[model samples]
Target: MKEDINNDRILLERLKNGDISCFEILYSKYSGKLYNYVLNISKGDFYLAEEIVQNVFVRIWEIHRHIETEGSFGSFVYTVGKNMFLNVIKNRMQEYLYHDYIIEHASELDNTVEKEVEYKMLEEQINKLIEQLPPARRKVYILSRVKHLPNKEIAALLDISENTVESQLTKATRFMRENLSPYCEIIALGLFQFYVS
Candidate 1:
């Protein structure tokens, strides 16, 4: 264990110096263990586990210069991986809950002509933004959000992996959010009206 710690310190030092070989070495040492750790937490969801592991390593690589070599890199890896998984779970749950809320309370929304016009305008703006996405991403976004398809269904329908579907949805939604956030109220109204309609 002491030898392993020394090796990790040396590897981390090289990693900080932009050594891809040392980075690969560290990845090899921890990826399987991290995958298993994440796998158990995901309740055997292989795709989520794989996604979390890859994201954790990518994040580590992104901020390698500031990594603390004297500390336990294993613990760091697990901590980062766990946090990433939790964030993914949190985001998924929020989306699911938001969808459920729209379904359950959609009819309760005020049905005024002014509100209908506002929702239509916002919906048109959102549609225009979505049209700016790359073709594959646009298709995925439409299938997932507009058509109310699940990731697995979208993947099967498009002959792509769930990871691809998830990635496309992430990028698509991020693009939408960045472009439309200033009109957040209108967008919310659009989404609520969209579902209710």
Candidate 2:
């Protein structure tokens, strides 16, 4: 154990000195263990575990220079993973809360001609933006969001992995959010139903 810690310290030192190969070495040593650790913590969410593990390594690579070279790599990596898991929980909670809030407030925004027109315009703009996505991404977004297909269904229909379907949807949503900004929320709450229903 002592020798292993010593080796990790040396590897971290090399990482800090900009030896990129050390990052790969550390990843090889720790990634599987980290994946299983996060998977257990996430209650058997394989994709979420994989995402968290990948993010943990990306973060370590980003902050390698600032990391202390003489400490427990296991502890450092685990701490980062734990924080990310908490963040995911927090974000998911916020999403549910926001969705509930939107549903509750949806009626307040209903039956107003001006707002109706505005929402229609926003929906049109959103469709245009989606059309601008790359072909594969656009197809995935249309199938998942417009057609209201589940990721698994979209994957089967499109002959892609569920991960790829998820990736495309994420990118498409991000692009719309970036481009549409404040109106995207309104569309998410209002026009989403209008289009789907």
Candidate 3:
């Protein structure tokens, strides 16, 4: 294990020097373990956890050229991964609290029956917007986002490539933006606040 760690450090140096093969080697070595770690902590919210993992890798790759050795590369990567996971959890919790606030205050309206009816109507509209997506894209979105499957698992379940699953999600998001413009705008604003602050 000590020798392996030394080799990994060398590979990380090569990766920092823009060696694609070294980067691939590091990815192949660690992706599964890191995915499982994130998945475990996320408690089945695999889609979000997967996004966190991707962000961690992207950040590492972007800053690799500047990351002078102050510690083990593995430890640095794991620290990045942990921080990303914490951010995701914090953002999700805030979103949950906001949704709860909306629901609670909505229930306190004087015209409770009317408010309920309006809420149901809005929910129906959102469902309609989702339905407007292409069949495959809709399925992928539902399974990955709603069902909370990781991309690899989603690919296996849908008999498609992980890249295809990602592509479908991108299309699904575009469709949602076009069809549910108002809701998309609101969500985008909320997400900006969630991440930027």
Candidate 4:
């Protein structure tokens, strides 16, 4: 363990100097443990776990310049990974609630033969919500969630840092949560129960 800690310090030093090979070494060493830690919290959502792990490494790389090591670097990485997983859970819950709101309202209108009309209205509302977002945030959200672009791709396309992409997505998701919460609580609860079961 002490040897691993010493190696991490050396790897962190190399990473701080913009050594991609060192970053790769660190990633190869830590990715599996971090993935398992994230997976447990995400309920085995591999994609989400992967995203969180990537973000944690990216953050470590970004902050390497100023990072003052007070303890084990591995512990630091784990702490960041855990927090990222929590954020993922929160974001997932919000998204699930929003999607559930659309489906539930659609189901209600289906029985009355106004399903098409109701679905269109819900779609319009969702679109409007997206439109109301700040331009950068909306773009990031659309590119990532709508167009299925990875964060790195979105960052490159937008000429922004990956952290910026993550930030924009986080903001967009929080905005959606605040807007959709009142209208979607029942749906959220039902979905949560279903998932728990």
RMSD of each: 12.6, 13.2, 11.8, 9.0
- Model 2: how far is 81 from its true place, Å? 0.5
Best by TM-score, which number?
1
Write down the TM-score for model 2: 0.54
Better of 2 and 3 by TM-score: 2
Task: Tell me how many residue pairs clash in candidate 2.
Answer: 0
- By TM-score, is 2 or 4 better? 2
What lDDT is reached at residue 89 by model 1?
82
- TM-scores of all candidate predictions against the true structure: 0.56, 0.54, 0.49, 0.47
Question: For candidate 1, which ten residues in a row score worst on lDDT?
Answer: 188-197
lDDT of model 1 at residue 136?
A: 100
- What local distance difference test score does each model get? 0.77, 0.76, 0.67, 0.70
In model 1, what is the error at residue 149, expressed in angstroms?
29
Model 3 C-alpha lDDT per residue in residues 143-180, reported as the tens digit of each score? 76554445654665566889999988887766665655
Ranking by TM-score: 1, 2, 3, 4
Put down candidate 2 lDDT per residue, 1-197, tens digits, no spaces.
34544488888888989888778889988999999999999999999999999988987786677677556888778877877787688658767876787688877756668776887788788788987999999998887666554565466556678999888888888787777776755665545543322
Q: Show where candidate 1 strays beyond 4 Å.
A: 1-6, 108-197
